[model samples]
Target: MSLRTGETIKFRSVGERTEYAAKILSADEDTIVIETKPGARPELSAGQYVILIAAETNYNAQIMSADASQVRLRWLRTDKQEYFRVDDFFPVVARKVEKNLLDTKASMTVTFSKEAIDRSPPDETIHPKLWDLLVSLDEKLNLILDRLNLEPEPVEAEPQQVNISASGIRFMIKDKVEQGDMLEVKMLLPTTPMVSIVAYGQVVSSECLGSAGYVVAVQFVNMDSEVRDRLIQYTLNRQREIIRKQRQLE
Candidate 1:
């Protein structure tokens, strides 16, 4: 099948379930070139075979050439199953779910509402005088809070290199978590207006790295459509940025 330049695609080694995100740099009917993050690049050599998933269809491809940044593959045949996934990094915080916390969903909604309001465009129909007055009042309130030292300092999670997709995320943590454990995950995406997401995940895998910590993989559960769309958009934008930078270097 034909592929477009700069289109995001997913691929993994034959017989492997873990997929990696890549961007199609160039393509033709028989051969295609793709680029991936240096860290996420698939371990491949010339003549190796892999599966490429694009546009919801899977294809078997033989690696024609491979390097740290790019790979060339010759299409072999198509598979029957449909698959899709993309990965990227963002700042994230995760914790084991507490059975006593009944208000977690409410807290998540409040956080999302605040971020939505902050990023939304001003109402064009509002009266100019009323808008100015509202802005003035907000400023005054901030000034008063500052004078009283009452403004709450924002609590931010330490940034980590996470492999995030719409379905789940994988990252390293100091603590170990057992498989099948439930976790509350919060991720901050550095989009144009920024997005903060809170979702519940079930731990699927956890591997100890000894002194380095543990690599934990979690699958998202009950994530809303809006949040999933936001994640997909962020990954697409990130892929474009990566492709642009790679082209410049070429």
Candidate 2:
């Protein structure tokens, strides 16, 4: 298997379950070199066996050399897994789903579609003439609103640091939520087009952090293929940006 420089890979010790992300610095037919966070250095050492995952394909490797910033591994062979996981941070807002809401699934679907449409910019290429007319109408509406001293309230939530994967998310919030409670989560991915995603998640864990608030872990449900693809792309893009910034600091 060939690995590209600066590409992100996830790995963990064969005996351990936790996975961590690393950037490939170089690769060859038999060996690959990667840079990981300093905290990971302790878990990896010469002769330690690990499982490395790249683009959903798994490989067996034995560590040749390990240090605070880099690890060299001798690739043993290739393996397979059903899926791969990647995680990163983004701005997120989550609220508990009230049980009394009727037709919850339909309501959530409509809300998700509307949020996506409202946040996305108008595509001028779809219908140029109609786009022009809509732009003119919007301008007139804004003018009328300005004359009436009426303005729409900002609905965007304040950006919060949220660790998110395609399957789940972890964030800190002030409200207490019990395990198994469902929540409506909305997040904005700071990508080229700034994608907005709305999904529902079930609370898996919630731990109080005293004055700081509570740390909540939620697993997403009812996610469609398109949203999952967007999440995977977002993670890959975020990994690239992180690696680029790390190189600049070197």
Task: Give me the candidate number with maximum TM-score.
Answer: 1
In the range 35-143, model 1's lDDT, one tens digit per residue, is 9899876578976657788888766666889999999987644433222344555566677875223123412221222212232228878777777667544443333
Q: Across residues 118-205, which tens digit of lDDT does each residue of candidate 2 receive?
A: 3233764557666655654444333322222111443445456777766668888778887656787766665433466777766757
**TM-score of each prediction:** 0.46, 0.46
Show pairs that collide, candidate 1: none
RMSD of 2: 15.8
TM-score of 1: 0.46
Q: Candidate 2 has which clashing residue pairs, if any? A: none
Q: What is the alpha-carbon lDDT of model 2 when measured against the actual structure? A: 0.65
Q: Model 2 segments beyond 4 Å from truth?
A: 1-89, 98-156
